[model samples]
Target: MKKQTLLVAVLAALSVQAGAAVPEKTADTVLKPQPGQTQAAVWASRVLTKLHYKSTPLDDAMSEKIFDRYFKSLDSEKMFFTQADIDQYAVVRTRLDDAITGENLSVPFAIFNLYQQRFNERIAYARELLKTKFDFSTDESYQYDREKVEWAKTDAEVKDLWRKRVKNEWLRLKLAGKDDKAIRETLDKRYDSYLSPSRKLTNEDVFQIFMNAYAMSIEPHTNYLGPRAAEAFDIAMRLSLEGIGCILQSRDDYTVVREVIVGSPAALSGKIKVGDKIVGVAKDDKTPMTEVLGWRLDDVVALIRGPKDSTVRLEIVPADAGPDGKHATIALVRQKISMEEQSAKKTILEVKDGNVKRRIGVISLPTFYQDFEARRKGDKDFKSATRDVARLLAELKKDKVDNVLVDLRNNGGGSLSEAVELTGLFIDKGPVVQQRNGENKVEIESDTNAGMAWDGPLGVLINRGSASASEIFAAAIQDYGRGIIIGEPSFGKGTVQTLFGLDRFSQNDKVHYGELKFTIAQFFRINGGTTQLRGVTPDIKLPTMADSDSYGESSYDNALPWTQIKPAVYIPAGEVKEIVPLLDKRHEARVSKDKDFQYLAEDIALVKKQRKENSISLNETVRRKERDTQEARSKLREARLLATPGADDPILVPDPKDALNKAIAAKPASGKTAPVPKVAGVKGALRSDDGLQGSERTLAAELEAEKAAKAAKDVLLNEAVHILADEVGLLKTDTRMALRVLPYAADTK
Candidate 1:
């Protein structure tokens, strides 16, 4: 028999023995490597070893890292497997490298099978504990985050851990006003839901997880996407999908709506919302609802997707609702939903600076996006961030905005081409970024187009979530002295990835393979320093909730180190460095007396205190006291803000889709200019100036007050606008300063 066939036979024999030892429900199905997986494993290993930017050898050291990563991926909380299980699996710890290269997947498959068995056992134990009455009066605690803890030495110890976990769950529900019977039923269903998803896992799913462990061990960004995930990746890049128009994420066997795309059917219905748990799905009114509480997220997505105009019904539990709360069913028509929410949006902020009201055009860019499929098919008007912002800049000019601020806060970046094109719109054509490959060959990527968009004055706002293309654009604008880089340091991801289709490596047409997104190059700013580990530091730094060590690239153990190459030759647009000190000083003076800033500092302190705690008390009284204290503080802040002047006035920022539609509607048939709509004082906008939806108010008064506290005014953006206004005033008074800082402004138009 062939090696692959022999391996399959051995796996089947092992499955039979394991089945005889476990319950029939848990061991009825065993996952084994599919035929195509062996080929895929070999292909992925070859491509990664040869073509990866790091070019790290797949030696013993790498094998051990892969082993630990795989185990962590399987049981990050260290709740399933025992130390004995790890000892037994140690034999293959240093052999995974060879297995991956030689097409031997038996070891990985065997380990996964044991993990599944252990998981089912834990779930069963948890369900059994639900039958016992849990005492909320006990002064015990539960260490929920166990990533750094040692594994239990025996099965009994693991069971003890699960006992505390179950007790904590019971206490949480009881605190949420659930009765004893309801708590038991909710927990019983939750544990069973956990087992259902594990039981449905396929061989392909296990293979994908193991492969990603190997890939991430080599580098942080390198990843393996299975066939289904590959298609999803394409859809994300195109920014369009035929579905109910919401992003879904899997959280503990529950499919949660992460975001409701604006202008999509779900958002129009105003029924679906972020943090809503999708428990069931139905094709139409006639079809019976299929319970999908424990279904895989991709499987649930498949059920939600259909032809345009088709109706899909979903049962959801609201975010504010407890697990035992009521569920509501909503029917929505599927459509080709363009992710217009991610597009660039503009709003004019009127800032009063020493009796001079300066109109600051603030553009919030969520990502650098492009519709690649449409662009490839020769569509001239294919959606892109650059094109949209260019149009917005022209409209801002017509509105007589004094300066422009591009808000890239929490923009995790998208297309590299769009970043370059967008940067081109700011400066008069120069090198934007540099690419360095494995061979150490450096190539410059420049914006060759010559022009300027809103060159009067500019600022780029960023935060820890800004990365890749966002960093590229910000770094370019900063390097050319074109704009003031504001806010927190970026996410520090400077590497570039190239997606490779795995099916191209094999000749067999029947089998569907996945894709590999591997790092191929590193990106450097025009000033020569790479943003690998040290993300772009803003010209005017703002206070952040967390330090760099708490998050960003520095948090990744295997992330690439910061480096520098030869700087690309480029002309500076103006001397922003000369005026940064004055801008920073003025900003500091204003925020020092600002009540909102003081509240922000207090919130940051509270977050830091919470982050330091690794465990929570299981006593219901102690937990409730802590919760009440938090609610009291939130109410105090809300009352203070409400007492401030203009607190009730809504800050009007137009929705991207609404703004685009109005701009189109305002155009005339005679080709004559019509009065452009005033971009201010529109009430009850869907999104705030900070790019987040207004919090949904709950029925509970305290909870509503807490949400209201969170929905306070955007102090950071307001400060940025003030800083820009100050710069405008400084330049207007000094002719020499104007000549030094406003060189590009004269060349505009």
Candidate 2:
């Protein structure tokens, strides 16, 4: 009999949740692959080998890559498993492909069991070390970047590395002004929290992690999403979820409310607040409450979420209440919570062009969103990025704006159709983007709309975070000469990912086999060049902290190479290229004297210098001095910018929800809508675009740092506005001169 046939017979007697029976010698519950998972592994492997853009075979060579990737995913810092463990597992390194293909998952599960054991040992050792005192005066450094380092050869070597790691943690708290007692308590809680999350990982989670290691070995974008992750992905894409409307995070075996969304049930109830701990949950008022204090976050969330209008009761300990304090019961009816924050928003900037004041409309799109379910239900007013943008453009046109700018600084793309439809709003009709499959067959995606929304002066703002669909829209606008692309070069992720729910391929509807997201096609600009690694180069580049080589798609190993095909048949919408040289010249002159721009350049230089360091000093005095120096420099720069003439605070714009509500209320009984009220323009903060940081600063200090970062971004937006204003002026005065092409950078194609 075949291995798959034998495995099917064995799986027939195993339980879905518990999987195969564990041995009596095992102290803790050992996670094993279920029957559905083995089937999914086989199906996913077949799909990747046959349909993936890379079309890489699942052979011994690929299996070795998956083996390395799996270990990296499990313990990238090389602190958990030793070289001996790796050597012991070497027998199965090149056999993973055969095992997956044959529907045998014993090797991966056995490896994961050993990893779990090693993880527990390390955590226990860390907890024990927290009981001892460390000398912070020692002049030693901890190399946190261990990606290129070899694994420890022995247990003693790993333990010594842990000693240095614990010391580094202690030094950070000490520099943050924590007392020895507080440091011990905090470290103890943190170590326990780390162990809690890892120990709570289910078999499904491990399977997803291992499968992704297999998929991404072929390319960076290919991934496998477990059932839980798949739901979260859908929520992100749809920008809405049916829940109580609060964010939760795991902390020391407790599910704590991190934030209460402004318009969520939790926010309206006024009973739940940030930092509150959820202790128990009940299906409804009548059902018995189930204690969930130590349950995994995803499990707790699953219990809390229900169908719309259904009641889910939560027992909580308030933020101000101690863990031993009284617990309160709160009942909230689940409802659709629209993540309006992620939706498109608009502001009108009154920029100065010489002595004339020009009104410029700016629309900030965080993502290309679409309510897929609502659209599939044939709802005429379904929410979509294109629909919202079209409405915003109409309102901006009514405000008599001279030009409009679409801000896509950190948009990581969504809904390829939305990108095409959004591009259609600017031009009458044209091909937006092209997709080439593995078979070299190209499909052209275009906008067949007959009319334009606002054919005025246009500008597109992008950064290293702008990718995929964002690149497509920006590239189309640039290719059609419809707008001037601004900011840094975008993230060069030109691949298209198609998500396949694995359960669809199975006969059993009761089992959730998770989902697979794999790259199917490569996106090409209408101008013929692929945006794979080169991304969409801006017509006018601005000062950015993002470096193309280190930050974008090119940074990933085995990323698809840049290529080009024959350009799609299209006509130029309007000529903005010839005038780009004048805009660039003016932009340079203005920013040269701008204080905010100078400060931003200096900060970027400091960040680049910091990125070069591989380790941090464990000495408290040295670390504290370094932190103080950087903080002091940041403060001085902020003060200088604040002192600069005309450096006003950002204007406040009306909330998008409030504006929409007002518009609806003002509509006539006959159904004609009234004009949206004009509110002061506001600049969207770019703090998140800078990426995450591990700072030991106080909350107040961090807030101030964020404020300074936003002020710097205002300078970039201000410069883009000025450039658009200049474009409007040049076009109005002399069309012939504005249409004259000048010698500048070569076209992207």
Candidate 3:
């Protein structure tokens, strides 16, 4: 997984009550054809053609076809409508067709009003249907008790449902009083507080509610964002806005921090971390803080993010801590976080086995990011993740690194264009990903650029956060045997959103409606496989605390299913299957004996278990017990590591002489604290073939610090030199090495 992957809002609007009875329309109010109508029709026809809508000479027949399709989608089961209603709808459809074709504004406008009226009636009926418990499946399979529709006939039964809703709301207030009066006051206060907002409910509010209900019926990810939410939606895609630099969600009335960006203000500040519950937010350091305990995530985010350099104070209660948790005010100054900030940085690690050494250059990409704003602004000097990694690879080559590990742990993908471009960096170009639209039209995305940057033994690491473009690139590499993928399943977010300009059609009072964001396309790998619900599977599975399977597009409320398209013509690069067996053996051996692997696995399991727990006892005694348990667990792990075989020996401590001296004395002479020298042989009594092992190596290793820092190349680079040297028997090669021909996945091949 590329580091640039993980980059990725909520609205709270109330529903409205509708009139019990429906109204009828008269013929006199219907639009009459005028002499200038033909000209208007021509204009409308030209506009639709320009917009690339399937115009098909939209006359009476085309209009009727569109109406049938629309109606079927609305009532797919053919329920709720009587024969008479169907006949009436057909007549209305014909009238609407004529109105639209004739370009008569009155008819279409009148039709819209009738549609709204009917939609409201439908909503009222649906609300009533809720009283009659319909079999609603929690899962997508929809396998449930669908034997009968039990309608609530009595007023008591209907009120019971209302009471359940009220109880749920009250429970959200954290009220637990044996006395009825106190609990009642708490419930009333909760309701009053929510209702006290002076914001007036407008027609747009009603539209949003309707749109959300409509979208929800489709799927969870398919959401309707009224014009008001367009700004936020756009910002999410661009991924260049300032906030706590974390994704947030409303998990049961509490806005929880989902994931923290690696180097974001939230992560850097080290104040508000993941799993912390935001209790309240004070804007511009206001004295009166608005309690956000039960606010929607979007509402909370709005308060959190502002203009660059502005500060928003947050009061957070750490999840590890209790309600009376230590509350601190941390002021964060916002900055324009660039794509470069979210990119992958290269680090070389030298792994030693006996006398042999291997250099693994790790490119830890925080995200698959591109400077989209800069690109859009027509700035040719845009920061590109793929390009940056290429440069890093070149630098590593100069150090004579052996292998490359692409760390994409928490990378959420950004910019489809960048994905294709990055995919090109590794292979002889071909189609990387396929995008299938709603119309079944497939668009093949490829790396048009020529050549590969660095094609040594490649391994890509991904986790649950890797999605979309990340999936695209990873799938291509895995399918083509270009690289071995490691980690958990990638996040399945393969849907392409098409933003429709709603303002073009209608206007409500002052604010014009913006866009109708819909899933217009689905992403597929070059192998004709879609990364929709089931994200790309890794080649070498690694231990991850993340439960990517529990969340993401497939698990989402309205996510599209995983499917496939016609396979593109391509061939596997080489046989990397041997590496899989090697990795599996290595992993098993490590898991069996390595203390770090065991500890990491246990830690992940513990965290996952902790995440599943709901309410914790707030009592002081229980809280203290929990804290003590955590402390005990932490100490136990630390003790276990210290007792491990290789670590049990006494170690040398560092002093003012610096890390080099400390490294020389640590446990084994080959110290873990210092960097190993890259030269063919060490000075003094140390010979190239002296072959120091274990504790000796630990103690003898030179502390990689001041000397390495002042040197042209760092200690890590020097270690990499030793690894690559051991590989090709070029340890004595003093000549500087450079990448001769970098490979690129060919898009047009």
Name the top TM-score candidate: 2
Candidate 3 lDDT by residue in tens digits, 1-749: 11110000011322111101011222123222333333333343444333321213455655555455334333332222323444555665645446545555453333333433433343344344333332212211211111122433443543443444443333323222223344445444433333222112233433343334333434344444554477655554454776657666544456666555545566556566655778888877655687876544455676787888887788787756767878766777765554334556777666554565566677877666666677889987667778788888898788766667777766777667877888888886678888876577888888777667866657787778888778887888888777777777888888765556545544234434434555556778888888877888876676755655355666554366667879988866645554465455655664566555566677788777654552234333444455556666655554544342242221222223434643343322222232222322222221222212121221113222222323322222222222232322221231221111112222112
Cα lDDT listed for each candidate: 0.78, 0.78, 0.52
Candidate 1 per-residue lDDT, tens place, 1-749, comes to: 01111122223222211111111224458777877888898888889999999998887899999999888778877888999999998998899989887888988999999988888788889999987877778888898667678989999999999999889877776766778897787778667655554665567767887888899999989998777777667766677778888877666667888666655777667676667899999987789999986655666777788888999999999876899999999999898888776678888877666667777889999888888889999999888889999999999988888889999998888899999999999998889999999999999988888788767889998999898999999999999999899999899999999999899977788786788999999999999999898899999988885556547888788999998999999999989999999999988998898877888888888777665676889888898887677667765665655554352222444447766875554344444434321222212211122211122111232234444554556768878888888888888777787778768686332
Query: What does the lDDT read for residue 711 in candidate 3?
Result: 31
Model 1 lDDT, residue 299, Cα: 69
Q: Candidate 1: which pairs clash?
A: none
- As a whole number from 0 to 100, the lDDT of residue 599 in candidate 2 is 76
TM-score versus the correct structure, for each prediction: 0.81, 0.86, 0.51
- By TM-score, the better pick of 1 and 3 is 1
Local accuracy of candidate 2 as per-residue lDDT tens digits, 240-266: 999888878655567888666665777
Determine which window of 10 residues in candidate 3 has minimal summed lDDT.
1-10
Query: Which stretch of 10 consecutive residues in model 1 shows the poorest summed lDDT?
Result: 1-10
